[model samples]
Target: MTLARLAELHGVATAYEPSEGVTVQVPDATVVAVLGALDVDATTPEAVAAALGAARRATEDRLLPPTLVRWRDDGPVRPPEDLPPGTRLRVTTEEGEVVEGLDWQPLPLGVHRVEALAPDGRAGGSTLIVAPARVPRPERRVFGLLAQLYSVLSSRSWGMGDLGDLRELASWAGRTHGAGFVQVNPLHAAVPGAPTDPSPYRPSSRRFPDPVHLRIEDIPEYGFLAPEYRDARDAVLADAAELRERVLRKGALIDRDAVWDVKRRALELLQTVELGPGRRAEYRDFLAERGRALEDHATYCALAERHGHHWRSWPEELRDPRSATAVVRADDELTARVDFHCRLAWLTDRQLAAAAEAAREAGMAVGIVHDLAVGVHPDGSDAWARQDAFAAGMSVGAPPDAFNARGQDWGLPPWRPDALAASGYAPYRGLLRELLRHAGALRIDHVMGLFRLWWVPEGREPTEGTYVRYDSEAMLAVLALEAHRASALVIGEDLGTVEPGVRERLARRGVLGTSVLWFERDWSGTGRPLAPEEWRTDCVATATTHDLPSTAARLSGDHVALRHRLGLLTGDLGRERALDAAEVGDWLTYLERLGLLPEGPGDEEAEVRAVHRFLLRTPAAMVGVWLPDAVGDRRPQNLPGTWDQYPNWRLPVAGPEGQPMSLEELAASPRLHRLLSVFGSLAEHRAEPGTGAGAGSAAGSRTAPPDARPV
Candidate 1:
């Protein structure tokens, strides 16, 4: 009983409601391990009793909670009931300005400090979080392009797509195809080593953008490299050309390590060049703004280059960022390496800004919609540097459901909810701020994590995990404040196993939810395709996602064959193929009935256009056209269940015949032009004033059978 009480106090669940009204008790061993991560002991009955007593006593003794959150729109904060009658309170803003007394004016939205003084000379301190009431929402409906950055190779790229390619893609899509935004996969820094994981969803640091995406020639200093380095630069360039040719001509997989090897060497030479006075001052400003987080990340990168990538393997003193021994170990050579990494971050940030600028210049309203990965790699800089912020020895994973009975362990550590609250969610705030720096809108992957997360104990299967709750109100308030400050829209990927009212709550807060076309159905009624009018107004409507089959693959029944070939299908291959074909036939039949599909059975490109045209018939605030779908690519950028069985995230954008297509080739394709003409014709509906309510045409309002399940 005491153990359960301790777990409850810490927001650790003793049992979870996997489905509404269904509760499953968490195992005792799991509870003990979870509590232990919180620095609480529950290993034995005696320990449980002692810990519970300590927890109760700690709450009673506190003059204030570790953190206090109040919306700026709300009236001035009231003093805590636990404060002594005559106790005085003083608040300090992040800018160092201080205010005294409980009659505090609505504070600015940020992390502030609060100090309490009692008549008896007692004192206490806490963090105060001020947030906006709600985030900003789009004023009108818009459509955009969705793409995976690395796969969209251009003629000027160094084997893999870089920021230069992003800029060009955005500018062309916005100017020529009338796209309002270009959503890209997460560009978060990956763990540095050979044979790096190709998936961007799992990254080393969410706070820092990966320098591997940097456009080598964009740095002004690149042009000034000494004539002595010309031969070496030429050789690197030749190698890059060969790599690019292999991907574009020979259909070779993208080699991230090879791309980074060339970029890293070139950056090393560029780092030797001195910055002008103005640029130096700007760099200093960036350093000052980033502060400790930037310094620690740069130091970790330097240390990783010296030792290996993982910080746990580093010497004891070096594990802690602020340790005196670690500082001493950062010699001149190490210091130079640190500076190089920092410069890379600044350069990447600059190019990202340039891409955003290019999009806006080419008439894109939202520009780039950057993705935020759910968590950081456990062995990466964030987990090592901010040790206290995460739960030790626990991995974030999905709960067992109808989709995957075995569940999934992502190998990313869950944040310690208590720690985040105590720090006024400083780390989360910092991450959002950095991501929004160059984004017009930000898409949060697994936004459900803001409420609760399934935590698997170290060495345990994902099924042996329990849901841990977070302070969602506080989390949303911080997100709203951040988005409001940045003038950026927020999109939550609220799909699969979402709790009831979660969608409603996010909508109320003005955070748009994702509405994939395949998943938007009237489940309350017949299990058929949802009428276009029934689709929600606040969402990003898309035909497919990176994890699912491409539009062409779905239409042609190619995904089934691919999965079967990779041995990923659970049922008989023949049965799977028949079911897949029927699903495609159903969608095609409905598209034909609506006058969207002009051609019959085997015309894949025309069917693809019809699918997107159906999306246009919906009232969703934003419609996302998968860049691959535009050119009839038949491969998914990622296949979730397989690792090496298929090239996930490494495949270049391809044609209908499975041939790689360069950006130049795509831009010149008449088929792409014809398909986009459909979107261009529907531009009027997108340009309709105000929210997308009643903005859709009535021509496609007839309901189809609700086959809302995603493949």
Candidate 2:
């Protein structure tokens, strides 16, 4: 390839002028070998000359670097003063080969390693170790949340799902369902106010959990509160009871913000009581460790409430995170509020740790797989506290694709690779360690980002975005190192637009991949659904994912109608409907062929169950059943693209009639028991093969009628 083309492929600009005809001094034999690999006819003088010219041009353009240099009889040449570490140099003489100061021996063909040596009498040496790059890891098994902790049982929660519900769900999955793991959306701290953003992905601070998930009765301070405050708590409980009644009797969607408002009021009253010595000490340690970052975050929230949430609209003195004026202002007026937020974070951390403990107590093999969002909100605590870590004028988004012809701008800034490396990846490592502290596994959303991210410059359209490469080796190395230390499994959400070789690399490092039945296809050819046996075992295989419609919605074609209603359908409605119908028909036929679906008219819920049972057919180490789908809940918890036009994240999981089910109701429901029974049977069957009809049947048995088998 030409130098310009190589530079373009590497996403490097080639504009620097060569001062003195940049010399490339690789061994002649090595040059011949590389040229041969490229299929160049080096034996011919003209071809040899052309190859040499191309090599020199490539080096000059910084696309390639020489491996070794030769000298007839000259003494060792001094290295360049400006040469950065990892620059490779070799000296060879015609008389005899004398390689000195070589740091790396038996270096691979294309990989690079850096080494530095002292200048006192000893010579410095560095070598680039090159090897064939590996592929990224495949997806792992991941469970989805049916509802947030405080939001699960509306009647019992101060207005949301609480820790008690989580404990119950964990116990049920561990003992009854025999599930490997349970995953939840980010439980990160939310801004303390009305109309809080419900999307967990866009959190105020990832380091802390939202106190709204706390159950009032469960709080240690609840019993010690003043009688009047206790009565106030009772009133909140009464309000929550009504909300729960609405969900059960009238089918109401969850109100996350309203729940938070109630919880905040109760927590404020409870905060008055002094914590015991042990708890107080723990809180102090947390604050000490968090230090200025926590202070800054809390101060920002306090100032935001006063000056509006947007940082740009804040008072000029408070705009800068480190300004003395801002510090004075915070100390004078926002100290109490800042301390309150910090206290909330400490309590949430305790609860998160408790939840993980609950999972262990429940006999879960892997407890609490926490999800790390791709990025935080642009105006959130992370962005404010760690501004230098982010790219100044760029946004992270997707390039033009079939799903989004206009491309997508996620409206979140990305980390500058250069800055991250310079800081020794402290921020990344810290975040990982904190999340993994209470998690059995950590799911990294947008795993492809570790390799490279599409950087959309400010004011530029997504189509105009350019791919900014990151040091994938370093990134993966850090991840593996952290996972190894934590003894926690790593699951990379390697879903859309993956670059080649990323999966293989991740798998090699023992990280797991994600596989959704809907998207698992023979992309190479034949357009066939990927066989269960052919699926990678080191992955989380599931029937559906959070981003996609539930199996019920897909089978009933409710998703199609919903999209059309939202005016999100780009193609003609008739054409889209025909395609959708054909896809659903194909799935039904495939299921019937495998004896998974009955020939008779099947209910959407039953079909959905069968589809999950089909997923269990795969040899995947982990299988996630979306919690909502377990009880035949049709509405998705989230719908992308439209924000206010649709209730994106507020919907509570509902029954067939759209009435919400409380945690207690869900736990006791026969419907849920039936679904858990499927998982229980699968686990039992997996323990001893050929015992159950589901375990005995092959996934591809076309002639076996669904009624003839139990799988």
Candidate 3:
């Protein structure tokens, strides 16, 4: 009971419902570990009792929480119960303006500093966050392509897709297919090393984009290099052509490390070419804008290059990013290396801006919709630079569910709730600001994390985990403010075992939710496929996601076979195949019955188009077409629960015949045109007012407006 009380005070869930009627009590050991992460000691009964007592005392004595959140929609400020009458308060707005007294008026939309003075002469302060009531929503129904950027290789790319390919994809899709956006995997910087983790979900830092995604020749320096360097640059380009051919012509996997090796060499030579005055000034401005965070990240990268990737293995004094000893250790040579990294960051940022600009120039209503990973790698830049912000020795994971009986640990460190509040969520706010700088929309992976997260202690199975609550009000307020400033839409990945009221709250905040077609059944009443009208309107509806099997793979029963071959199936292969086949048949039959499918079964391509036609039937404001689905790719970009057995994230985008297809081939493919025609038909309806056949018609043709004004 004492332990439960302590847990409650820390917002740790001592018990949770794994299923409808099953309540699983978190073990006492897990509770202790979770409390330890929060800097609360509760090892034994006596310790728990003492902790509870201390918590109660602290609450009684404090006049304000470390952080306070008030929504603009909530009206005015109400004084806390503990505040005595006539207590003086001074509020400092984010803009350096100050407000006096405890008036019942609304504060501006920003983080304010509030200092209170009690009648007894006691003084304390707190961070007050005032956020916009809701994020901006899409004005019209928009359709876009969702893709894994690295897999969408172009003929000019060096094995893996780069930002240059991204730019071309956006321009082509926007102009040719009338795509409103091009949504891709998180471009967040990966931890530096050979054979880097291919999954974009677990990044070293969410604040910076990865340099590996940079297109080497796209750099201004490359174009204006000295005549002497031309031969050397051409030689590198020749090697790159071979790498590109190896993936597209041959059956080789995308070698990211090999591609980066060549690009790095080219970059080293280009770095020697001094920048023009205007370009130099622009680079300086970028450095000033990024400030210390950029410096720390660049320093860490240089250090990683020098002393392996892991920071823990480095010398003791160099562990802290700001240590004077570390500064001394970083001699002139290391300083030059750090400057090189900073330059690379500046170049990458410029290219990303150019891509977004090109998308809008091509008439895209929503340009590049960037993805935000849920957490950072445990040993990466974010974890090292902001050590105080993350929960040390703890990992983020999911609880035990129907998918994996043992649950799953992602090996990513979660933010420490207490630390985040104390710092007024500076780290999180800064990250969101940078990401939204060039994004038309931001998709937050695992949006439930704002409310709470399932944290597993280090060295423990995922089952030995408990939920740790966060200040969702403050978190959402910050998110809303950032998106409002950017005039960008926000989508939350609200799938999986969501707690009650979470979806309702998110919808109220105007942050869009995610809706996958296969998962939108009427589980409450009939367990039948949800009719198009029954789908949620406030979501980005799609047939599949990156983690799931593609439409063709699901329809053709190849997914089950692939899983079986990789030993990822927990059940018998025959039974799994039967279940999979039945599910696909059910959907196909339903589509055929609804007149969406002309023919089904063996015509997998036709079935794929029907599945998308079904998506168009939904009233969702936004629709996402998986790019690979249009090409009839049978492989999942990423196969969850398998590592080396499957070349997850390595397979190039392929055609129905399992042959790798370049960007040019995909654009010209007859099959892609057929799939895109379905969207075009819906787009036609959306272009007309009062047609009522398209989701946009009901909204009075939000998308039929003139082409977006280019920035």
Q: Which candidate number has the best lDDT?
A: 3
Worst 10-residue lDDT window for candidate 3 reads: 702-711
lDDT of 3 by residue, 454-531 (tens): 999999999999999999988998998888888788888887878877878888888888888888777776667888
Residue lDDT tens for model 2, 515-577: 778777676667677776777776777776666777778888888888899998888988988
RMSD of each: 3.8, 12.0, 5.2
Report residue 401 deviation for candidate 2 (angstroms).
0.7
Candidate 1 off by > 4 Å: 72-84, 118-122, 324-330, 681-711
- What TM-score does candidate 2 get on C-alpha atoms? 0.77
Give the higher-TM-score candidate: 2 or 3.
3
Ranking by lDDT: 3, 1, 2
- Ordered by TM-score, highest first, the candidates read 3, 1, 2
User: What are the per-residue Cα lDDT tens digits for candidate 1 across 405-500?
Assistant: 788898889999999988878999999999988888999988989999889999999888888889988889889878887888898887777766
Q: How much does candidate 3 score in TM-score?
A: 0.95
